[model samples]
Target: MSDPTFSVRPLDEDTWPAFAQLVEANNGVWGGCWCMGFHVRLKGRTAAQNRAEKQERVREGRTHASLVLDGDQCLGWCQFGSPAELPEVKSRRLYEKGLTKLPEWRITCFFTGKGLRRRGVADAALGGALTEIAREGGGLVEGYPEETDDRAVSGSFLHTGPMAAFENHGFTRTRPISPHRWVVTRTVSPT
Candidate 1:
């Protein structure tokens, strides 16, 4: 069950500080990713570069995310944006081979704070993303999530999130992109 005290908010200029706090607390997330992997390739950029770019995007309103908060402290986030905003994804070769059309929105990554795993932060963030998408004139939303049915995958590698979580949010598996990763999609109606 989800905690009633958890609340959701959009990642904008107002919430940038909270988002930064969570990422900084996690060692810039995945060794300095700063959750910018889907937005742009890191290549040779440092953690500080990633941080600056991410903050710039936020200020320009170019990024989108649903931040899960616990009393003003952001616990995690679900990153979502238009295909143009988030062009990078895992399993690009396989995903593109089967891709007929692009989804209006793509849910690329999810992050939960330390010691808060399995406590519904990801679910709350997912739910929040869907709600925000709906409010922004919903359309087809896509996600690449891992299937962890029979294996022991580390939480560190499950950045794309688990298949079960997307399933719980009404997303259906459209096709398999890799052995453990599948492309899940759902059409959220506009609110």
Candidate 2:
């Protein structure tokens, strides 16, 4: 087992490739669709188009982003920015309603490489995200996680971390849009 100590830092050119690779590595679960389900719905677009659009957003997001790492390996990332900065999140029907009522950061998808699971990586990632947001003087950080009994009991989600990891990082349940979806938040600053 690797040491539990790792650093979290702002996403940059040097760090993005590893993040993209990890996302691609999980193509079956997160690939094909461009990670755009929470951002936009491409009614008739081809998979390539979806991938391109998502990659474009990701390229932009890297400059204004947060990521977790164990040495040089990108362990996880939390994609957050202004609603305008993130068209996908801003345009999503489920996320559009209560936005801008406060300044917030969104915790998007998380990915960990094989053999890296069940080792507190998610908690470390979330902690890094919170601290970085605080350093940047951002407002609250938000997360939308699937609510599931099996996850609550076991704290696993294929390669994705479970909701309890967010909760363990001080995120409280704000609302549940459906039995499987929830909105949670942890306010980092009053502004």
Candidate 3:
């Protein structure tokens, strides 16, 4: 169960400060990624560049996320966006090979704050994302999560989230995109 003390908010101009604080405190989240890995390639970009680009996207309403908050502080986030909004997904070749049609929304990654792991932050964020999606007139939502039943995986590498997290939100396993990563999906009705 998610922590009841946590509240969810959409990542927008009003909530960018909290989100930026969390990312900044966590060293730009995954070595200065700033949670932009799923949105665009970060090979030549510096951390500052990534931060600027992410902020620009948010300002332009091109980025989407559910920011999990404890009071005014952001604890984590679940990023979801349309295909055009976030096109750089992991295992793209394999995912494309099996793609019959594009989903309306894709949950690309999650970020939990320092000293706050394994405490249901991810679950809360995922739930929040679903609710936000519904408000946007929901449809097919997809997530790429790793199956962790057979092995121990580090939280850092589970940016897409665990399969159990998706299952908890009523998502069903669709197919495997990698050895441990599977494409999971669910349909959320508009709220």
Candidate 2 lDDT at 144 equals: 73
Please estimate how well model 1 matches the true structure, expressed as its whole-model Cα lDDT: 0.94
**Please, what are the lDDT tens digits per residue for candidate 1 over residues 17-97?**
999999999999999999899999889989999999999999999999999998999999999999999999888999999
lDDT of each: 0.94, 0.61, 0.94
Between 1 and 2, whose lDDT is larger? 1
Q: 17 in model 1: Cα distance from truth in Å?
A: 0.9
Model 3's lDDT to the true fold?
A: 0.94
Q: In candidate 3, what are the lDDT values of residues 99-157, reduced to their tens digit?
A: 99899999999989989887899999999999999999999999999899878898887
Q: Give the TM-score of candidate 2.
A: 0.71
Worst 10 residues of 1 by lDDT: 155-164
Tell me which residue pairs clash in candidate 3. none
| TM-score of each predicted structure versus truth | 0.98, 0.71, 0.98
Candidate 2 C-alpha error for residue 182, in Å? 1.7
